[model samples]
Target: MASLGIVLHASLICIVLLTFFSGTASRNIANEILQRLEMVEKLNFDLKKENSNLKLEMIDIKGELKDIVNEMKVWMKSRHSQGNNKMNESNSDLQKENIKIKLEMAELRDQMDNVVRENCEMKKKWNELDDILISVYIHLNKSKPEIQSGIMPEHRTPLSYQHVAENRKANSVRSVQRIVPPAPDVTEQPVAFYAYMDSYHTPGLPIHTTLIFDTVQLNDGHGYSKHDGVFIAPRTGVYVFHWTIQTEVHSWESIEIVVNGSPIGCAASDTLRINDYGTGSGLVATRVNTGDLVFLRTHESISGYLLSNHRLRSSFSGWLLYS
Candidate 1:
């Protein structure tokens, strides 16, 4: 009976031990599950925070993109407007240039037409002048025989007019002798020269400056030098020298005819009105010895252009009256 009681006590002890161990294992398992749930909750809270931050960043990015788009549109519009304005301005400038060219062309055409008309008129005038010259030449030939013959038929007049008729006849003969040139002689050399300036002389000529006449029309005795614009007397005789000077409008000049360093004649040309050119002439008849120097010079300081052109000329001429 004692062995049986001992076995019951052991079994009771084993039962209590097993119940305590089971209770401890269940409590440990419950604590582990609660820890796992807490960790998952913490992870979910962190994810939510990260999502909110990402949304805020996206909002900021969207605002920046809108600003960039608006700026690009404004820039594009400004560039297009500027290009159109530049094109318009360039077109206007080109049009203005074209108009100016057209105007210039029109002016050139008008000038050409006017020149053509003037040329036609000049041709007609030249023909008329030729006719006049032909008539004069014919008349001169007809009168040559009469001039050579010294016979004059006496007209029948009343006794009271006899002395008057004689005087008139004598005067006519004398006038004829003066007008006609003497027949050419082998021994005698005719002395004559004529020259004109080729172009306008510059203003402000110095005092005592020799005026050059470079365009020689005639130099029969070969006494005129184009290099120095001086004529050296070829023979001792009486000489008649004449000179003409032209000055521009609103200007004045004084010139002199010089012979052997002495002033033989003085002339002045002055113009006070616009387009009114001035011309002055001087004439001198004096005895000139062989090798005497004759020229034209500025008498005083000049004040304007000394004009010499096709229409107006400054000329010097000289001829021997007798030698």
Candidate 2:
């Protein structure tokens, strides 16, 4: 009975040890599961925050884009209205001048007709006078020897008639000439200009660099300089500046528009897949003094290899609002 009791006790102890080990393992597994749940919740919260930030940024971007579109539409309408007004005024003046020219031409034509008629009548009178002088000369010649033997042929009345006919011809010829004044010179239309420019892409850009655009498609009035990424304000006014950047797969970048060494705005993009693309852009309007400096900067997070410089990929643009 004593031996049986010892064996029973040993079996009981083995069973107890097995049970305790199992219990500890189960508790450890439960603790590990709870820790995993908490970590997943934290990750979810962070993702939610990032998503919220992205949504807000998208909303602000949409608002800004809408505002810019509206402003451009309004500006275009005003310019078109002004052009139409100027064109209308010019057309009115041209029509008035044309009407005046037609009137003057009509008056000139009437004067010319009168001159022609006067000339024809004077010629007819001169011919008639010449015929009468000829007849009188013939009659006087027939009686010159009997009526007045002292009268010379040079002193005959035909000579005076001839002079009178020549004078009438000269007067008619002089009256036929008319002088017309020249038309006024027409002025050319001026070219319309707006302060705007666009730049794109750069190769071999160092890490965490102030992106200096080397190529320029358009720069009016020398506002943007390709030498440095700095945009010099030509006038004291509100100006809008915009920029875009592209990143390689599994890469990210933060772009900021800095005015006079201070950041005005930022936009960032991230891509998680290999060989994929991420693009971002930002716009800002700031009141700037003349000669103020402005440029785009790449944040330190994207200080690695930058995959930019494609057709219209990474771009910068600026324009003045009012001066």
Candidate 3:
């Protein structure tokens, strides 16, 4: 019975030790499980935070993409506007060029028409002049033969000249003129005139006055007007004019040849003693058109009175040199 009791005690102590070790192992395992659970919860929270940050980054990228799209649209719109403007400018330039070309062509046509018209008129005048020359030449040719013959029928006298031969005695020679030479034609010559101051007396004004050529002693073809004291040219030509003035003693005289109230030349003279005369003369040759005026005027220095006697103290002479 004692042996049996000891064995039972030993078995009870083993059971107690086994129970202690098992409890200790179970507590360690429980602590390990709590630490692993804490690790997992922290990881989940970090993952959620990372996911929120990624969403924010994606939103920023989307905003940047939208801005890029807007900028590209604006750039494309600007390019389109620029292209339209350039095309419009080119079209406008072409239109202006077309208008300029049309204007130039119209002007050219007008100038060509003027040239053609002028040429036609000139040709007509040339043809008329040629016809006149040919007619004159033909008429001269027809009369040339008759004029060359000495015994012409048109030139013979009605009564024959045989009686003059019977009346002629020996050694008595008679001069018989069969043909009379025609006198030269003087009508085509230019008209000329020489006039003298008829009424030469004291000047009415205090100063010198215009020299009035009252009497035209030699007015050929009435070219000079006596009342107006002017010489009116009949045709365009070169004319020579002269004027002379004579003043009494103790006085000075001056004269000028004037054209249309403008003096072209002047002459001056002064007397030295009493009863003496001062002579002033002026001569001019000028080209004048038809209806030009020419006259002589007394200068301002010519005072008192002018002298006119048998010698014709004051005289004006003019002649047309050419036409």
User: Best candidate per lDDT, number?
Assistant: 1
lDDT of 1 by residue, 35-119 (tens): 6555755777788899999999999999999999999999999999999999999999999999999999999999999998997
lDDT of 3 at 316: 84
* lDDT to native, each model: 0.70, 0.58, 0.62
Q: Which ten residues in a row have the lowest lDDT in candidate 1?
A: 172-181
Of the candidates numbered 1 and 2, which has the greater TM-score value? 1
TM-score of every model versus the real structure? 0.42, 0.40, 0.40
RMSD values, in order shown? 19.5, 46.0, 25.8
What clash count does candidate 2 reach? 0
Error of 1 at 175 (Å): 47
Q: Score candidate 3 by TM-score against the native.
A: 0.40
Q: Which stretches of candidate 1 lie over 4 Å from their true place?
A: 1-187, 273-275
Error of 1 at 255 (Å): 0.8
| lDDT winner between candidates 1 and 2 | 1
| Candidate 1 local distance difference test against the native | 0.70
Per-residue accuracy of model 2 over 282-303 as CA lDDT, tens digit each: 8888897644556776654463
